[model samples]
Structure formats: C-alpha cells, structure tokens
Target: MGRSPAADAEFMMRDTTSHPPAYAPAYKTSVLRSPKNALISLQHSLSEVTAPVFRADELGPLDNDLIKNCAKDGLPVGERLLVHGHVRDQLGRPVKNALVEVWQANASGRYRHKKDQYIGALDPNFGGCGRVLTDENGYYFYRTIKPGPYPWRNRVNEWRPAHIHYAISGHGWVQRLITQMYFEGDPLIATCPILRSVPSEEQIRGLIALQDTSAFVQLDSRAYRFDIVLRGQRATLFENHVQGTPQ
Candidate 1:
C-alpha cells in the first residue's frame, strides 16, 4: 500500500534514461547506513560495495495472495505495479534468490507499527506490511491499498507521502535490503527523506503510474500493480510470508 511522490512533483515529470547515477553514490551511502545495514553504516565509503556476494535460485512462487496481502485493506487487491530493471548485483548485476519484503501505510497514511499511537484510528486487523521475493526476471509484484500521506516526527510540519518499504535477502547471508517505493504524483514527496535521498535531477518517471482499470486492478476489490527492481548479481526472487503485526 504505497504511492510515489513523483506522481505530483514537477521534477518527477521529466524523463531520464533510468534514474541518475550522480546521486547513486549518495544513495549507496544512505542505504548502507540505514538501520538495516548498520554494519556498513560507519564504513559507508568502504570498497565492499564491489565485493562479490553469494546468490540463490531455489525459491518457489507465492500462490496464496490472500495470506500475503493485508486482508484488513480488503480482498483481491489489483495488480497495478508495472516495473523493469537489470538483474545484477548491488554493483548493478544479476542477483539470484533475493528475498524482498515490503510494508507501507494504508490509504490513511498510518502504519501498524508499535510506534503508531493514533487512538480511535487503529485498524487492529490491518497491520501494514507485505513480503515477497524477486524473480530471475529481477522483477516483483504486490496488490495492496493505495498509500496515503502520513505525518512524521522529522519536522513540525513534516509528512511522509504514501510509500512502500522493501527488504531483500538472498544467499550468503548477504542480508536483505530495506528500501522503499514511492508512488508518483504525491504532493508531500518533495520533503520526504526517502525521496530526498535520490538525485533531484534524475527522471523518476517509471516510478509513477495512474490507476488503471484494464489491468484488472480495483482500489477496493482489485490489485494495484507494483513492481520492484533490485540491483544484484542475477535478478533473484523469493516467496511471501506472514510477518505483519500479530492479529
């Protein structure tokens, strides 16, 4: 359940051949330093980014969409995410058997995390989280609710636009990556730390998508098509799990 800010920002309007790499170094550092990768956070500038890591290819497909989806958000979420990318390592090569995890706030911009304290606004049955793995195609998909802008503690007037966080893991205990996907056209996208991490000059085109009906996606009953591209050795994939908050 997420939305990328590129959907509204003018900067997201321009087109570029893939996102800008000039900002890649910055992102690499950010991703490495995030709580998910604290091991490399202090060494953000280390040369290990080019180090060869292990890979896997034995993951099966996830068939039980009902179990994987946040049923609290409703059933039969549409397949609206359409994505493409390279099947390479973090250095930008192909990664095999990469397990990916996704979680985001629902249409109300509220997550089901323990930190959330919105009284009278909690969906006890709607914990905000989703898990899935990438395929050899370096692709992944999800059907969830539309992400809504939510308030944050970053600033007095700060708000995090609708977005989905992805955590990927594969062979060699390489560790799963914890990143986020943003919906295009979201208004608060400009100040969001997640988006600010990317290059402002880059064309965040492929990141946005208008609601599509022909795709068999219904906001309430259909699925939203969301695809993920992981930079790894060979595009690896994984299955979905029930890691959301306990019912």
Candidate 2:
C-alpha cells in the first residue's frame, strides 16, 4: 500500500532544533529584530499559495552570467567562479523550475549601493547580482566572481566571512526562502558572529559550499557545489522562514 498524507507530512516535517534562534545574542543585530510575541500558525490562503508563475522567456540570456551581464568596459577583476547545485525538497524530490537569485559584494567586499561606506573599491564592470531558474531535474548554475571578506560593526573588529546571499522562490509568494552560502576552508567562517549564531554544527556546515574541482572550467573559473534542501531534517538554514515549514 501507499503511505498516507499524514505519514508523508510527518516524514517531511522540519526539525526545529536544526534552525538557529531568532534572537542570538552573539549576533547583536538580532536582538531588536527578533520576534517579541508568541508565534501563531495559520493556514495559507489560495492567493498566498498560488499565482506568480515564472517563465523562461522572462529571463534574459545573460541573466545567469554575472561576469558579463553588467560589464561596461571589461570583465570584473576577481577570482572567477562557477557555482552550481540542485534544489530538492525535504523528501529528496527535485524542485523543478524554482527561481534562484544571488547577489554578493565585489572582489574588494564592497557593495554597489551608495549607503555602503566600506573602504574597499567597487568594480566598475561588476553589478554583483544574477538569477536563474532550476531545470527539470532541479539543477541550477551561474558564473560570477568570488567575493572577498569584509569587517562589520557587529562587534569591535568583527569581520564577516566571504559569502553569497541567495533568495529562492518555489511556486508562490509564501514559498520564498532566503539564505547565505559560505565557501569551504574559510577560517573566518568559524568566527563570524552571524554564522556562529546557528546552534547546530552540522547545520552550520550545510551552509558552506564544497569546492568541486571536477566542475571547474580549465584556466577560467573554479567551481563550487551548494545544494539546498527546502525543509525537513536536513533543511538549509533559511533566514526568513524560521518558524514553520513552507508547503
């Protein structure tokens, strides 16, 4: 016989302990940003679960290539990288056609935004953003430069590790998930206040992308694999949807 709906749901239920506390004291900013009241669970309305269909034609041919998408004079100066991964649900099923977006600082660890006062210089040719939709098998890849680390005011002399910010949307508005991806072997990962906020060492490791030498482009770019699991026992730590699992 087949498993019941309740059984399947139970199997895919996320382990609350896998996620970090919203108000981690070490991550100072979370203090005021964390929720102040008890949480409430509600059923999703049709509008929240549906609509906002994505189409391949909506994306430009260069939308997935950050290296050239924003180039005006020449290629951006930095270590070229090819990041690829699979998007899977808690049940290990491929999440086909999911929209994945990524943005990061330039090689000097400076954002293109005007509010950023970091001393690092910005690359004139790099926009530091890109997006791509997953294929039928849940595969997605993009090319960009590896961002550098930079200091933050979270604590005296505190430095954030080099990382990429990701925003993934499944089927609807309610399915949008946001997270960060760190590179493996970065010593700063162990000390970053934001990363240390995560309680589980295993889950912390999940956020780090592994270097994939096999996928490297000869003499061009190095590759890294950072697969994402939407929810369940091994869900990737999403910053936005911390309280409950998304349907």
Candidate 3:
C-alpha cells in the first residue's frame, strides 16, 4: 500500500484557532452572520471522525478533464486556460494525492445549472466541472476556460469576480476545503463582498491566482497558477511549543 498522508501531515485533524470562523458575520449567507441564529451561538466541539481512503483505481478516465465531458463536437467556445498549482500543508510541506475539484461559469458568465438565470447563453460543450489528484510532489494541473464575471442580487449592478470554485479533499472529510479562486487582476474583486468577507487581508489575497503566460502549454491556451494551503493538525501545537502561548 502507498504511504498515508495522515501519517505525515495529520491533515484530517481539526484546529479551530487556525481556521476561519464557521460563521463570519460579514458574509451574508453564513449561518453565523446573524447573532440570533441559534446554531452559531451554541458551543461546538470537533468530533473524532475518519474517512475511507481512496485508491487511484477508483478514479475515472475523464475525471481530470472538465472540457472533454461537457464540450460538444468541437472545442468549447471560450479562452482556453491551463490551471495548475501545488497543494501544501500549513507547515509548507507538500500534500500528495489530494483530490481537487473545480467548477465555474462559461465564457459568457452562464452556468449549466437551471436556476442560474443569468440571461447568457450556456455553452453546450461546457458543463464546467473537473477533478484531478495531486501528484507525489503535490502538483495538480487541469485544462479549463476563463470564467467571466456575472451579476448577482446583492446590490444594484453587483457583479462577482471572475473565479472558479475549488473543492479540495485532503486525507479525510475534516480536511476538505471549499473556496473560490479569483483572477488576480479582476476588476470586480475589489467590490465583491464575498471576497472581502475573509477577516485577514492576507488570506483574502491568497485566493487570487496569477496569470502565467510562460506556463501555457497549448498554442491558444492561457495559464494560471494557484497554490492551496490546507491547515495541518500539528501546526498550532508546534508553534505553541516553540513560541510559548501568548499572555
């Protein structure tokens, strides 16, 4: 059997101090946003939970290629893009075999979902979902298209930034992370309330992936690099051991 990530990283272990609050008030949709929300005010504790280990044989042929399943007869109509990145733990160690899934709108800001109601034509060739496993070196790469910004019901002329949804599964369910990655120079990023909901400016900045022309492998495709950091179980403990607890 291959090595277990939990042995090296203990990624499934929970650390409340290192992670964002489950309910940040600034994020309107968060259950914790309202003080009267009974769920948020209640005391919570991390449960000792474990998940089944996934083997490589379980993955399908097209799981890593989002464009293949959704595309019609020809290539999808959009700016082709290559999204690649590394998955690391809080201590900066690489986490291999991580399951990474992504989904996004088509070039015209239209999603395949029926309820999107964006008034834009959905690309028949683009269902906009893909998955890939990180390599031994913690590298994961996939081909996709640049999703366009779309308006939401938040405010008048409120448009979301061009972004792709990321769902990463580390060693177990406790390590699973769901977040959005925005384009570095997207104009709507500054005004998007969702991106601003993160309490730490540095954490918010980490969500933006930078365009890298040099990483482009195809003739017509652009490249973007995004690195993800999963919180590790031992990180806070190790820091406390070294620096001592704050007074």
Predicted model with the maximum lDDT: 2
Better of 2 and 3 by lDDT: 2
Supply the TM-score for candidate 1.
Answer: 0.54
lDDT of candidate 1 over 67-100, digit per residue (tens): 3444555442232342223234444444554555
Candidate 3's residue-wise lDDT over 119-157, tens digit each? Answer: 888888888998888988889999888898888876667
- Per residue, candidate 2 scores C-alpha lDDT tens digits across 17-97 of 867889888899899999998677555455444435578999999999999999999999999999999998777878778
Q: In model 2, what are the clashing residue pairs, if there are any?
A: none
Stretches > 4 Å off in candidate 2: 1-14, 232-247
In terms of lDDT, the poorest run of 10 residues in model 1 is: 5-14
Query: Which parts of model 1 are misplaced by more than 4 Å?
Result: 1-96, 171-175, 203-214, 218-247
RMSD of each: 13.9, 7.7, 5.7
Question: Against the true structure, candidate 2 has what lDDT?
Answer: 0.84
